[model samples]
Target: MAFSLFILFLIIGVIEIYAFQAVKTFTKVKWVRLCYVIISLMSIVFIVYQFTRFDRSVGQTPMFMITVGLMLLVLIPKLLITSVLILEDGLRLIVGSRNYFNNYDKEASFLPERRRFISKVALGIAAVPFLSLIYGMTVGKYNYKVLRHTLFFDDLPDAFDGFKITQISDIHSGSFDNPEKISYAVDLINEQESDLLLFTGDIVNTNATEMHPWIDTFKKIKNHEFGKYSILGNHDYGEYVEWKSEELKNKNFEDIKDLHRQIDFKLLLNENTKLKKGNDEIALVGVENWGVKFKKVGDLNKASENLKKEDFKILMSHDPSHWDAEINTHEKDFHLTLSGHTHGFQFGIEIPGVIKWSPVEYVYKQWAGLYVNMERYLYVNRGFGFHAYPGRVGIMPEITVLELKKRKKVV
Candidate 1:
């Protein structure tokens, strides 16, 4: 799907460039004529399909986004030219113009005064969201502080009570070439009064060795009973990277497993543990990363092999997709699931009830914030470390302090 969109953009960009060149060169016939003729037709089809699923051929690729810019470029001139015609025609009907617009002239009446006004307003509506996106990128920072007061389950066992769980996911540790930036993130996490820290996958981008240099600083962070726990993300299994030998790749994964143990983070590896809180106990289950068409390290079968279904399980699964596919399907078995690979696309909004945003929402339904499926809930963190880009534009780095609150039973 991505490649298709890229190629489609490449084609549209070529036509846009050619059209611009033709205008600059003052060609007798605009090169945009033929290309736009096609787009004008496609737009009619696309807009219609958006309203109904009655009939269709698969779906259109979003490369049409690139086409929107091209269309506006051509539409603007047509808009202005036709707008003058409508005004002159109105005057002809009102007073009279020497070169009056006649009902007989089709081109002059192409856009009547009232319809032209409405079309211009429609164009502005289409452009508002794109402009707001730019504004959000500049003014908004993925500020995590707003999350300090969100509702949490308070009756969670003291073994994990006031247990601030600082989570960071999709670290893609190998992508960071800067050590100072990494140190800053480490310092921030360490600064929080977190009882236990959880890293729910994608710890290393392509190799287990990626998290090596930062290990020293990471060890400095406080973790104890509420120590630290981790699970594999889709990228952790080295599936996307090409290796000289499969054995070498497997060995590297093992090394990553041991490394987490060295840092005091027990890699859940499809297993559950009981954290004692006074007279009560809460279960923490960590599964290997598994999600749609990605790595399948999640061993729900193995993870729950020896555990009781009634146990209050807090699962650490990398992808939220896992919750949809496995956890949610297990009835209301697990109380809560913690996941973070989404990074909220490192962009988008999480405002509740006002206006919600995030492209990742179209991918994973529970891409950010909290979600309740039946009784099992999932919290998708926006991650601590940045991937791909070192700077965050909208989505800020996060250190979530989730206080699991429990309500008294209603008889």
Candidate 2:
């Protein structure tokens, strides 16, 4: 690990040097150049210092999130500049070799000076991500977008033909720095006034206490007519942090589960409830966090033990991967499954209908939005909050409103 880190820093140093050269080539002002170097060095030192102080027992603190954000903010732009400079250098090397071998510029200089135009272009390119990251931190994280989808399912109960369900996931409350934004989001959720509200989890980063401050802020979410329900996400297990003892870890898990109740959301734990509407009903089955790579505590069979395969069912599993792995192909048919663990990687290009893409897609087939297999459907909420880098890019936080329509049989 130490050797790997050493190499990583060595590469960063080289990239920084190349990036500095681009700046130097672009400007002759000494103060501007010196200021850039000083800021870069200070940022690197601060990030390293904060990382060194990170404790396994107290994982993902606000300071640690700042360090990660700062590191990415500084490093990504430099990487872009360095890549452009390296490409220019490669072309220069080929040209210089040809000139030296042919003795073409004997009186003139050995190699031509670096072009100012190239430096200008590199700077322009680097500015894109730099500004985007800044905007992501400041505004994009709180940019809540309500995505609406109408899914038609032949198995949907007639009573729920026009049922509207709102979903938000991956709160990661520990990362929230603004209360007003959260309150506004709750209001936005209330504005929907859906028949039901469901939360697919990651309520806090790691510790249960991370959500303490925002309990009341989230409690503002109004009750839905059909009811409000939630299921745990992988992070809710408190597995990312190192607890002093197993008992403490268990206690934290218990507390995390109670958070849903405090917010008026009935916490579902490998259980199924029947949402009755008049004479008909639909099975709302919720299992614990089940993922392809993360925790696998969810018991689908046990959760749906009382329900038959013919029943109209809506499964709430945190990770979308569970749908790709088991739910879609399970013995019991799940008409609709709701999930939100991917968070669209919190970075992606999503231009609805025209284009939808994210880095997380390579890992999760149903990373975001709706997906269908056979007759079953899964809707993956982008997320409600930020984590790790403490910002979002193209993939804004989401409040999903879905309307279920029963497909009529063709004559």
Candidate 3:
């Protein structure tokens, strides 16, 4: 992952250098152009190295060091060009009012044209952030395409009766690093009046330590009479980082598990529980991260142990891939399962009827919203918190309220 990211950034740097040279057509000077390219590339590399902690992730020895060096090489040049253009814009803007066309210098030379040129450059620069804000607020918040659906279930139990479960996935508490926004999400979830609440994995980004500060905020979540339950996401397992030892890693995992106890969420580690509504008893089984690449070791049989042959069932496996890859073809299928690992690639178009595309769709058929396969149903929440990028760019944070309607008699 580190190598891939570094290469991608380096490619970005090279493009920046090429772009600046193209700008040389507008502002010509061999000495100035060379200096700009060199400085800009260097600055970009430096910023990226500092940003990604290339020093700390020194695993592949010299390979890691080389990638970091290359990333810095690529990062600095672009950074420099961007900074210089900003300063040039300020210089042009401070000069008394004049139309940009009138200000254009046709023959004085590249240096003389700097003012109008940089002003245009500045306007372009300013447009990016403003446009980013507009996109993040509007299209980003409302966009998603229902990938594949398991909504047409024939065996959905009336025990849930008319339950609409609003599921959220991968809140990634570590990423929430910010407190205010998390509280706002909690308020929204509570206001939704969802009949049952489900958290389909990744409640925290990683570790019990990350979850400590926001315990009170998460406690505010409201659930329907049927109750709220959760499984674990890949991040929740604390598997990526190195611990003092396996024992220490195991201890850290257990501590985070206990944190779930504090939040009143039942951690379904290949385990089942009865969700009793009146006389109706349906088994809600959840397993710890039963994913393909991650870990598929959890024991579904153990979770299903107490389940009677006649009880209706639902599984909360974090990855939807688990459903099609294994659970869908399993001898016994749960009436419904809930999952949320794909945040719809944090980009897509979801409008009323004509929705389409999220890169996450490539990996997950049930990427967002609902899907129905024969009698089985799975709903993958598009997540409630942002990850990788701190802000959600093209994807809105979701509070999925699922309405679990009962199927009428087959006879």
Candidate number of the best lDDT: 2
Best-to-worst TM-score order: 2, 3, 1
Error of 2 at 233 (Å): 0.5
- Minimum summed lDDT over a 10-residue window in model 2 is located at 104-113
Q: How accurate is candidate 1 locally (lDDT)?
A: 0.64
Model 2 lDDT per residue over 1-411, tens place: 999999998998899899999999999999999999999899989988998899999999888888888888898899999999989988888888889899786776666778999999999999998998888989999999999999998777788889999998999999999998999999999999799999998999999898999999998888789899999999999899889999999999999999998989999999999999988999999999999899699999999998998999999999998997899788889999999999899888988779998889898878999888887789999999988988999999999999999899999
| Model 1 / residue 286 / CA error / Å | 0.5
Per-residue lDDT tens digits of candidate 1, residues 1-411?
999979965755554443333333332355555665576557545643543442122111223322333344344444443444445457646643333454445456443333344444434443554454444333332333425533345345544444456666776666555566566667777776666678887777666766787778667766655668888887677666557788987998888778787777878888888777677887788898888858676888778766777777788888888887888887437778888887787666555578668777788888777788655678888776655433344566676666665544568
Q: Is candidate 1 or candidate 2 better by TM-score?
A: 2
Give the TM-score of each candidate.
0.67, 0.98, 0.72
Look at candidate 2 and tell me the lDDT of residue 241: 85
Tens digit of per-residue lDDT, candidate 3, span 1-411: 999989986767555744474367455568987886787667666656655664321212233434443443344334555576646546546542234446754544333335445535644654554455446543444332222222434555555667666677787776554466677778877877766677888876656776788888988886467687878788777776666678877887888888778887767788888877776777888887877767776567777786765577878888888888877876656777788888877656667577757778777777877777875777777787655443445557777766666656678
Model 3 scores a TM of 0.72
